[model samples]
Structures are given as structure tokens and as C-alpha cells.
Target: MNDVVGALAGAVGMSHVIHDAAAMVPYLTDWRGRYTGRAIAVVKPGNTRETADVVRICASARVPMVPQGGNTGLCGGATPLADGESVVISMARMNRIRAVDGANNALVAEAGCTLAAVQQAAEAASRLFPLSLASEGSCLVGGNISTNAGGVQVLRYGNMRELVLGVEVVLPDGRIWDGLRALRKDNTGYDLKQLFIGAEGTLGIVTAAALKLFPRPRSSATAWVAVPDPQAAVALLALLRDRCGERVNAFELVGRPALELVLRHIPAMRAPLAGAHDWHVLVEVADALDGAALDDMLERAIAGAIETGLAVDGAVASSLGQARALWSLRENISEAQKIEGVSIKHDISVPVSRIPEFLQRARAALTAMWPDVRIVAFGHIGDGNLHYNLSMPGAFDNAGFVARTGEVNRIVHDLVAALNGSISAEHGIGQLKRDENARYKSDVELDLMWTVKRALDPHGLMNPGKVV
Candidate 1:
């Protein structure tokens, strides 16, 4: 172990290689604080070459390598296991925006660059990189790519996988696979870049990426609408799409319980509507033309939805402050829920058309079994994803309630599988859902995933016990 640490220190210098328990403490725990592990050392490589060298040294020594980014992942993808035989490769030192092609509307950025930094770079280049998430300030692009993170704008721009055109990765064996071609079209053989996009670093370390950009939206509109049920929310989404077309940038669903939690825990968060409704939809539209009559468009769409009985009540943001406030309510759900108490959360997705049935059946089944459990369900309805969460009823002890997480997960995940939905929507399987994934995934699918893992990382040195 000392020799392995010495080799890593020699490769990246003593300053970059941290073996002391104090220095390794922070990297040992995950963002959610659910996972804590011990590592032989935490190595910070300056660039792809250094990263590759460190990986090579570790591989040769039969030492496991866990590639980590900003450590803001909800899943334990960035966290090492408790084995204490792994070396965490922190990518923070490789922070650099390699290039920004304004003409092509693409940017090549290192793995350590925060999502916020990438967004700022795109804005500076007069373009848009629309992957927006609550953890944008701390979540690194590499982690986002690894998890294939889906955020608020996924309804319009898709997830991290869609935003990336190419990737530069260091394979598990320490070879750099520089497939960073920024072309819009390339049909040569297999699209190898995709394999690592959402592999959660189990296959390789994503060193950098060539990301796709879009024309910046010059005008925007936001609205909060109350719907009778999930079906009505889906109908409202269809109405907006018919009226506003591709301009519908975001469409999030906020359940009454979720909104109530925000209003209760998050100070100064007021209800958008006077009375409570079973469901609420937060919609955003954007366009490239300034003074593009977005307000009128939003008004027309909302009015149509209301007239058609799809939306019961609505409020369009009259100012930027109001827009921010509305978004705050949606974005702060997880934080607010955390403050509320221990909750069993599921980041799930089904087909857009099947969302209504999923919610209906899931609610019925869960409520029938656990009558007192509080279901605080909400999320990106446009993308058929929901942050379906469960909290203890009334005065139950939070810790005791949390102990039933496994039972709750079995119920929810089984229902999700029945609906042909993913147990993990935006968040990767990571360590949190790996076992659940195995239970839900088909035998053939599991075999293929293991096959891929074996092919790329035969030694099982890269992010072991994650994903496949």
C-alpha cells in the first residue's frame, strides 16, 4: 500500500497525492452522506496524461481506481467502497475549458469544470449549453456526463448524454481513447463515445468532452399552473407543445405535498395559488427573438389549457424576480424534503403516455400497503420523470421510518419495472441503486452490461461495485 501510494505521489508529485487520513476524509464521503468509504490515498492528476499515468501505475499494482469529480453526485457514483484498497482520482485539478467553437456552437471542456462554469463559457460565446441542475455550482461536467444527468432543461435540450458530441477518456487499462471529434455527424463504426457517457466511470475516466451548444434564447416566460391530476398535467403539457412548439423549455410537476414542504421549510417561499390542488405544473418557454411576445404566447397557452379544463388555475411570472421565485420552489424540493425528515426517494421515469397510469397505480399500491406514508411526489413531467418520494406520516420517528427504505424501494421499483420505467431516471445506479438495478434489469440486459464491463475493465479496477 505504501509503495502504491509512493508510485502515485511520484507520478503526480507529493503535493497532488494525499494519503493522510485528514486529507482523505472529505473525499471518502458522498454528497448525500449516505456512503462513506476508506481509500489508500486520494490522487489529484493535473491533466489527462497525469491521470493516465496514475491509472497505469494503479492497474499494474492491482490497485483499484475510483475516478471522482466535484463530489456533488446524489448517487454514490463518485464515492469509493469500504474496501480501503482503492485510490480516488480527483479531477478537480484538471479544470480547464480547452476550446469554444462559436461557429460550430460547441465547447471542449475538461472534466473538472463545474456545470455552472460551462454554462458561463457558453453564454460568453453567445451560445447556450442547457443542462441546468440544482447542483450546477458544484457538480463537475465529468460527473454529469458519467451520470448522464438530467436537469430542468432536459425537457428541451435533453440530458448530458445528448449535449455531449464527443469525449476524451482514459480507459481502465491506462490508454487514452481520444475520440473527441466535435462533428455533428459521424457514422463510422460504433459510437464509442456513448459507452462512457453514462458509464459512471466504471468503464473509464472521462477526461474532457466536446459538448453541443444551441442559439441562446433571447426571450423567456415562466408560469405555474394548478392541475386536477397527473392526467390533466399531461394534457396541459400537450396543449403547451401544440401552441408553443419547441419553445417549451421546461415543464416540471410539483405535488401539493412537495410544494407544502418548500413553503414550510424554506423561508419566504409562498404558495403560487390560493388553494391547494392535487398537482401543479411549472412551465417555461424560451425563444431566440427578443421581445418575441413570449408573454402573449404563454397567456394564450395557459388560457387554452384552462378553457379545455386541463389546468384549473395559473399564474404567469410578471417579472424576473417572480420567475426566479417560481423556479426556486421547484429546484428546492430535495433540500426542503431533507429538512422535513427522512424520506425514501426515487428518481424514476416512464414513457410520457404511461406517466398517468404509473402515478395512479403506484399511488394505489403504495397507499394500500403503507396507509400512513406521505407521498411527496414531483418532477420533470415533460420528460416522464418524477422525484417520487415517501415521508413518514404525522409523528412517526424519522429514523425508524427510514429503516423501512428497503421494503419501500421494493414496492416502488417493482411498480416502476411493471410500467417499463427506470428505477433511476437521471441519477445513475451508482452504489445506492446497484442492487435494485440488478433486481429490476432483465437477465439479458444484466449480462450485456457485465459483458461491457468485463470487456473494458477486465481487471475490475475502475469504480468497482458500481453500475454493472
Candidate 2:
């Protein structure tokens, strides 16, 4: 192992190879602190060539490799297992924007580039990269692609899979496959880029990507609407889309508990509406043209909602500060929950229309079993993804509640499966949910996933103990 580390150090310089236990601690643990892994050495590679060399070395030694980006993942996808033998190939130093073609509405960025950096580059070229997440400031673009992240704007733009035009991946065998083509109409053979987009770094290491960009929105409107219930919020969403069409870029559903959590933990974050509401929807609309009167359209649509009893009350943002304030209420839920206590978080997604059913059924089933369970349900309702988290009971410790994770997951995931929903949504099935995910997937689907892993990785060296 020392010889192996020595060779890696020689390849990418000793300064970048971290073998010190204290220095490597940060890379070994996950962002959520749920997964703590062990690694022989954490190698920082500067470019694609260096990454390939590190892969080649690890492959020749038959050692497992865990390709990590910014390591901002909720799941333990970037964390290695407790084996203490795998080498972590950190791509932090490869941050670079290779190219930006404004006319083509595409830009090529290195895997190590932060999502915020990519968005800034798009803005510089008068385009929009609409993948906006709370961790965008720290999460790398490669990790986003690997997980196929779906964010707040997924209602209008789509997931990371749809936003990406092409990828440059270094295969498990240390071979580079540069599939970075920025073509909108490429009906070529296999669509190889799609394979690695959401593979969770199991097949290969993505070093760069060609991402799709949209025209920048010049006018925007944001509103905080109080709905009677989840079903009513769904109706309100439909009304907004009917009146405003595709301009409705974001539609988030915040439950009372979710909002209360934010208000309790987050400082100076007041509810936009006066009285308490069981459910709220944060709707945002935008247009590419300036002075498009989006707020008026939103106001009129919200008026129709109020008339139909879909929404009981509402508040529209009159300025950018107010818009951000409204958005902060929705965005601060996770942080507020963290500050409160440990919880079992689920990133599940069902059909857009079936969201109400999922929520109703899930809450009834959970509370029926654990009547004291604190449910913090909220998320991107437009795309059918909800971050349904359950906090520890008032009398119980976090460990006690977390000890029943298997039992809790069974209840939640079984309902999700019944609703034709995904057990792992946005956050990939890293080690945290790897075995739990197998419980819901069909035998045929699991076999097919394994087949793809074997077909690409062959030796199961890339990100072992992750996904399939």
C-alpha cells in the first residue's frame, strides 16, 4: 500500500496526495455525517490526464477507486466503505470552464467546477443554467451529473440529465471517452453520454460536461400562496400553468410542519401570509423578455385560485429582496430541520398528480405506527419530489429513532412503491440507501442495473458498494 501511495504521489506530485489521517478525515466522511469511510490515500488530480493516470494506476493494482467531486452529496455516494484500501480520486483541482458558446446555448465545464460557477459562466454569456440547489455553492457539477440532480427549477428546465448535452468520462479501465458534443439534434447510435449521467460514478469518472443553457429571464414574479390542502395546492398549480403557461418555472409545496420548523430554527424568517395554513405553495414565474408583466399574470391567476377556494390567501413579491425572502422560507427547511435534531430523511418522488395520495397515505401509515412521529414534508411539487423527513419523538433520543430506520424505511418505501414512486430521488442510492433501494426494485430491474455496471466497470472497481 505504501508503494501504491508512492506511485500515486509520483504521478500527481506528493503535495496533492494526502495520506495523513487528520488531513484525509474531511474527504472520508459524507456531508450528512451519516457515512464515515476509510481510504489509503486521497489523491487530488488537476486534469483529465492526471485522473486517467490515477485510474490506470489503481486499475493495474486491482485496487478499488472512489471518484469524488465536491463531496456535498446527501447520500454517501462520494464516501468510500470502511475497507480502508480504496483510493479516493478527488477532482477539486480540475475546476475550469473550457468553453461557452452563447449562440449554441451550451457550455463546456470541468467536473470539479461548482454548480454556482457554472451558473455564473452561463450568466456571463447571457444564458441560464437553471439547476439551483441549496448546496450549489459547494457541490461540484460532476457530482450533480452523477446523481442526476433535480432542483427547484426542474419544473421548467428539467433534471441534470436533461440539462447536460454531453460528458467526458474516464472509464474504469483508465481510458478516456470524450463524448462532449454540444449538438441539440444528434440522433446518433447509442447515446453513450446518458449511461454515465446518472450512473452515480459506478461505471466511470466524469471529468467534464457540455451542459444545455436557456435564455436568461428578464422579468420574474414570485408568490407565496396559502392552500386548503395538498390537493388544493395541486389544483392551484394547474390553474397557474393554465393561465401563465410555461412561464411558471418553480412550484414548491411547503407543509405547515415544514414552515413551522423553518420559523422555529431560522432567524427572522417570518411567514409571508398572516394566519396559519395547512399547506403553502411557492410559485415563481418568469419570461425572457423585459417588462413582461409577469407579476400581474401571477396576480390574476392567483385571484382565480382564491375564487375557486384552491388558495385561501396569498402574497406576491414586489421586489427582488421580497422574492428572495419568500424563497428563503422554502429553502431553509432542511437547515432548520438539521438544527432541530437528527431525522430520517427521504427523497422520494411519485407522479405529479399522485403526490397528494402519497402524502396522505404515508402520513396515515407512519402516524398509525408511530403516533408521535414529527413529519416534515416539503419539496418540489411540480416535479413530484418531496423531502419527507421524520424527526425523533419528543421523549426519544435520535439514536432510538434512527435505530428503527429499517422499520421506518419499510413503511415509507412500501407506500412509495405502491404509488409507482422512486425510493431514491435527487439524492442517488449511495451506501446509505443501497440495500434499502434493493427492497423496492424489481428483480429484473436490479439485474438490468447490475448488467450495466458489469458491462462498463467489468471489475466493479468504480465506486464499489454504491447504487447497484
lDDT, candidates in the order shown: 0.91, 0.91
**Could you tell me every candidate's TM-score relative to the true structure?**
0.98, 0.98
Q: Give the distance in Å from residue 173's predicted Cα in candidate 2 to where it truly belongs.
A: 0.7
Among residues 3 or more apart in sequence or in different chains, the pairs in candidate 2 whose N, CA or C atoms overlap within 3 Å are none
In the range 10-96, model 1's lDDT, one tens digit per residue, is 999999999999989999999778899999999999999999999999999999989999998877988999989899999999889
List residue ranges in candidate 1 displaced over 4 A: 394-396
Local accuracy of candidate 2 as per-residue lDDT tens digits, 1-468: 998999999889999999999999999999878899999999999999999999999999989999898998988999999999899999999999999999999999999999999999999999999999988899999999999999999999999999999999999998999999999878969999999987889999999999999999998999999999999988888888999899999999999999998999999998898988889999999996454478888988998889988999998999899999999999889899888878999999999999999989888988898787888889999999999999765636667887898899999999889889998889998888989878888899899998989898888899999998
